[model samples]
Target: MDKHGAKIVSVFSCKGGVGKTTTVLNLAGIYSLMEKKVLIIDMDLNSGGIAVSLGVDATKSIFNVVDDMSNNRFNTISNYIANYNENIDVLAAPKDPRDAFKIDSKYIDLIISTAIYKYDVILIDTTHILSPITLKVLDKSDSTLFMITNDPVDLKNARSMIAIFEDTEKKNYKVVFNQSKDTGKDYFTLFDIKTIIKHNIDYTIDRSFYIKDIDKYVIDKEILTLNKHIRLIKKGDVTRLTKIAIALLDKKKNNTRSEVA
Candidate 1:
C-alpha cells in the first residue's frame, strides 16, 4: 500500500550496455511470480526494446496512448497496455523511432498517474540520455535504481551522475553494479567504487547470470519463465533476483507505512 498508490521504480544509467533492461525484466518477473500486479513502462522511446526483448507484439504503444491523451482521450491508457502475462503488463515504446517525437514530456505525469491506479508497482526502463522526459520519470519515481558496471567509463559516468543527484538532493537512489566479474586479479572493488562516487554500491549482479541465448529467449517470448533444466548457477541467479525484488517491495511498504504515520 504505497502512499502514492503505486511504487514506481526507475532503472536508469548514464551509460548503456549495463544490463538495465535485463534487470527490469527479471525484477518484474520475480514480482509477478509473487502475485504482485506489475507494469513495465519502456521510457526509452527512441530505441526501447522491452517488447522485442520479450518477444511481445507492440501493435499499440505509449506513443498511441500519449497521442490519445493529447487529444483528450482520457481512460484510454488501458488500451495501449499489452499483457505480458496474468500478473504483468507493459506499455511499450513506439515501433518507429520517429513516432516518439510526437509524445510530449508533459503527458508523462498523466501517464504515470493513470498507471499508479492500475498497478501495484511500476517499473520504468529509461534511456541513458538525460532528457526532460527522463528527468520527469526520475522525479516521479519512488525509488531509482542506477545501473552501472565494473567498467571504468561506466563508473566515471556514474560518479558524475551521483554528484548531480546529490546536488539536486535526490536521495532515493540505489546503485546496482551489473555484469560484475572478478578474476582474482588486481581490480577495482566495491570499496573503490564507493570511494570514487561517494555512494555505496547497493547490489552486484554476476556477469555469468546474463543469458547467453538471450536472443533465443526473446524469440521464444519465454524470457520470464524459468526452464526446469536450467543449470544450478542460473537457478541461484533467479533466487538472488527474487531476493532483490522482495527487498524492494519491503522498502516500499516501509516507506508507505511511514508516510501514513
Candidate 2:
C-alpha cells in the first residue's frame, strides 16, 4: 500500500507479559492526536485489556460484531467500538475466551477489510503466544511490530519469532523493545538486545510513570484518562511516543532525508 492508503499492523510476540497492550494503547492515543482515523482491535481473546487500559467499558465487544458478521449483520461493529476522540475508535476483545475461537480466518478478514475501509490505520493486539488467530493476523498484516522486553525469556522468544517469520509472507516486520529500566546501571542496553535478536530495533520505550493502583478500573469498566498530575509530568513521554508513531507512518521520509543530507 502507498502512504495515503490504509494499512494493517499487528503487534505480537511469541511470549506474554511484554507490554504489548500498553504499546498499542499509547500508539493509538498518539495517532488519534495526529487526527488520523485510527481503530485498535484487541484480538487477545484469552484475556484482553485494551478497554481497561484506555479506561473504557466492555459492555459490547468486537465479538458481537463478529457474530453479527457471521450472521450477515455487520452494523453491530459500529455500535461496539467505543469512541475515544473524533479520530480514535476501539474494538474490545471478547468478554468470554471461548468466543474467540468462534471467529475464524474468513470472519477476521471481513473484520479487517471493513476496518480498513473505515479507518486509515487498523492496529491489532493479538495474544502473545503463537496461535491460529495470531497466524491469521500475521498473514493479513501489511506490517508488524514484534514486541520484546529486557528479560532473557522475552529476548529468547523474540529470536524464535524472527526465525519463524523469516520465510513468511510478512517480511516487513520490525522490533519494539519496551519497559527499559534506566537505573544508572549499564545493564543490557537496547543495542545488546538488538544484536542478540539479529533484527534492527525500531523502538525502545523507557519504563517509567506507569499507572499505579489502578486495578479497580478493570472491574469498574472505566476509561483510563491520564491523571492531571501525570498528564503534566509525562508530557515529554507523550511527545516522544507521537514522534514514533509519525515515523512509523512516514517511512520513506526517513530514507529520503538520509540520502539528501
Candidate 3:
C-alpha cells in the first residue's frame, strides 16, 4: 500500500479526557519546530475543539470541503486549510454539530490522500466515540497512537480496543500513557497497568509543570512556544515530546528504506 508520500498518524483513545487533543497539539508543535511540514485534522466531529483550543479561525472546515467535493465543486483541500505557522497547517472540524452528520466516511480517504502530497506528516485527533468514521480513520492510519491513562476504566477500554486490533490483525499501534501521576500506590504501578492491558506501555508523559499549565497555554494559543525558563520537570516533558517526534520520523525512514530494499 502506498503511503501517498507522507506519514499519517492518528491520535486516538477509547475514553475521553485522557489528553488526546493535548498530545496531538504538542506533537504537532514539536514536529513544526523540527521544520517538518505538518497538517492536523480534527476528527472529533461531534465536539471538535482543535480550532477553538488553538485559537484558529474555523469559518471553513472539513465539512465544507467534503460538501464541495461531493458536489464536484472542488478537487483540492488547500482552500479548507488554515495556516497555523510556517510549518504547521490545520484542517478544522465542522463549526456546527449538525454539519458533522453530512461527513461521509469516504471523504476521509480523499482528505488524507490529498493532504499527503502537501505535507510531510498528517496528524489526526479523534474522538473517543467508536463511530464508523473513527474506525475508518484508524484503518487508514500509518501509525495509531493509542492514548490511555492509568485509571481502571481507561485500562479496561484500552484492553478491549487492543483485542479488536488483534482480531483485525492491525499491528501498527503504540500504547501511550499520558498525564501519569506518582501517588505511591502499587495497584496503579507500571507493572499493574501492563499486566491489566496485556501490553507494555511504549511511552509515558508523567505529570509536568507544562501539563499543569496546559489549559492556559492552549486557551492563549501559545502551546507551540516553549518557555526558555521552564522548570526541570517541564523541560523533561518537552524533551520526551521531541524524542517521540524523532522516533516517528525514524520509523518512517526505516519503512521507506525497507520498501526500497
Candidate 4:
C-alpha cells in the first residue's frame, strides 16, 4: 500500500497490557525510518506510559497545552511536541485523570490539524478503558489499530470495544495481535481468534526482549545512542507494523477516492 499525507493512526486496545504502548513506539520509530515524519500523541491520560515507554518524564502534557489555550496563552504546536529523534515527535498525556475530562474533541482537532500540517503520520496512543477523550480520539482517527492478544479475557474486552465502535458506525479499523510466545504449545489459532472477535487479524507482533529499552530510549531521548541496542532487536516486528501503517495510509486514500468517485 502506498503512503498518504496527514494520516491519523490510533494504536488502541480493549484491554491493558497488550503491548499497545510498545507497538506505538516501535511503529513510530519504524515509520520514521520509512522517511515519514511521525507524531505520537499519548492520550492514555490516567497512566500515560508513552513518555515512560520512551524513557521521559511525563510532567508536562496535553493538559498544559489545553490549559494554555483556555487561558489565552496559546502558542505553536511546536510548543507541545517533544523531540523523539529527527523524524518523530511526541505529545505526552496528562498525569492527572481529572485533567483528562477537560480534553474534548474540538481542541483535539486543533492539535491534530496542527500536527498534520507538519507531519505525515500522526500516531495517537489511547488508554485501554473507555472515556470521552478516547471516544473523541477514535472518532477523529483516519484509522484505528485495535491491539489484541491470545488471552481470553483480552478477547472479551476486545469484543466490547468492537461493539462500541460498531455502535458509532465507524469502519476504519484493523486488529493487531501481540505477545505471542509460541512456547511450542498448542493454543489459540488465528481462526480461533477470528471466530472469537469476528474481525480479521491484520498483523501479529512477536514478543521481543529488548522491549524495555523501547521505554528507556524514548524516556531518555537517546535515539542515537540507543540505535545499536534497538537495532539488535532486528526489524521483523516493526517491519510488519510498517506494512500495516502503509496499508492504513492507502486505505484512507481509497476512501477519499471512493468519496470523490
Screening candidate 3 with a backbone cut-off below 3 angstroms (N, C-alpha, C), the clashing residue pairs are none
Q: On residues 47-98, what C-alpha lDDT tens digit does candidate 1 reach at each position?
A: 9989988776799998988877777865757788888888888999999999
lDDT of each residue in 195-245, candidate 3, tens digit only = 889998988886652344556776777654343544344677788878877
Prediction-by-prediction clash tally = 0, 5, 0, 7
Q: Give the per-residue lDDT digits (tens) of candidate 2, residues 1-261.
A: 234556677788767766677667667766765677888999898799887676666778877887887777767457878876677788988888888778775677777766677787888998876777778787777667787777777788778778766644346666777663322433577778878788788866666535554466445433332234444666666666667777667646322111000
Worst 10 residues of 3 by lDDT: 252-261
Off by over 4 Å in 1: 1-4, 180-187, 230-232, 251-261
- What are the per-model C-alpha RMSD values against the true structure? 3.8, 5.5, 4.2, 4.4
TM-score of each: 0.89, 0.81, 0.90, 0.82
Clashing pairs in 2: 54-224, 55-222, 55-223, 55-224, 56-223
Point out the higher-scoring one by lDDT: 2 or 4: 4
Candidate 2 residue spans exceeding 4 A from truth = 1-5, 180-187, 208-231, 251-261
lDDT of each: 0.78, 0.70, 0.79, 0.72
Error of 3 at 210 (Å): 5.7
Ranking by TM-score: 3, 1, 4, 2
Query: Which tens-of-lDDT digit does each residue in 1-261 have in candidate 4?
Result: 123357888888888777777667767876777787888899887778777666655577899888888888887878877776788778898878788778765688777766677888788999887676777788778887889888888887787767766665667777887754332322588898888887788777766433543445655655422366556565565556667767877753423210100
